[model samples]
Target: MASSTIIVMGVSGSGKTTVAEGLARRLDVPLAEADDFHPPANVAKMSAGTPLTDEDRAPWLDALGAWLAERDLAGGGGVMTCSALKRRYRDRLRAASPDVFFVHLTGDFDLIERRMRERKGHFMKAGLLRSQFADLEPLQPDEHGVAIDIGPAPDELVERAAEAVQRA
Candidate 1:
């Protein structure tokens, strides 16, 4: 959509990666998985069932921001799957590029928690779901983006999000 960098954002198990990949396919751009950028320490903490403090997330977010900035400067765009739980976290990404946009995936906590429980081999624990929701500040009034419920299947959700991006 308009060649801007897209951030498919939501807490873990909300299908951010699935949606981002589908959108990138539709948009003909690359897809970046936020989990790939996490430092070993961050991964270790998550695997140990410890939630990341803002301090712990700063470096990871910076690395992601830098990636976005570099892609933007090169006049190319991609979709990134990140939690971006807090407003400040999102602001950090937006600071990377003027055309940065977010797509918030909203869903019932129980639904997502169930999904998390069903998932295997992910560093993030199902117990961390509540902390994520607690920290989340949904897209603000002035934010440039779209918010969609994550109840549907991946294909439908991606289509809806892509439509929103097109409209934006």
Candidate 2:
């Protein structure tokens, strides 16, 4: 199969980092975290429990796209995390790498909120989950990716996503 940048996307607390890490290892490719691409100002807003405006995310998305472009050009597509909750955001990544693939993690709101509350040392607060869900646009039929539910164990979910991503 042709290589394509894999974007592990979902709302915060949806195990994006976990799945991305495992998938990167399984695929033997480098990994990048979308959170690391965010500017300090954006992190501060989310830390304060305020939802980020589209303006706050533009630079972050561009940075991720650049990362994808770099890896795609290198002929070794890698994995990355992003709360690509909108179709337009995903489109921006696709513009950078036409074959970009998304592994969208989905789960019940209550379950995801519990994971967020249980997480520590993270800038994002559980309170902002509502805003994230409000902005989420799941993978469309025409999109080049798969949607995997987050209900299973972390390893199982990663295995399932890795298989789908590899097949695609």
Candidate 1 colliding pairs: none
TM-score on alpha carbons, each prediction: 0.97, 0.97
Give the residue spans of candidate 1 off by over 4 A.
none
Instruction: State the displacement of the C-alpha of residue 4, model 1, in Å, after optimal TM-score superposition.
Output: 0.7
Give the candidate number with the greatest lDDT.
2
Cα deviation of 72 in candidate 1 (Å)? 0.8
Where in model 2 is the C-alpha error above 4 Å? none
lDDT of 1 by residue, 1-168 (tens): 557899999999999988999999999887889999999999999999999999999999999999899888777788899999999998888888767889999999999999999998898999999999999999997888889999889999999989988998
lDDT of 2 at 133: 97
User: Pairs clashing in candidate 2?
Assistant: none
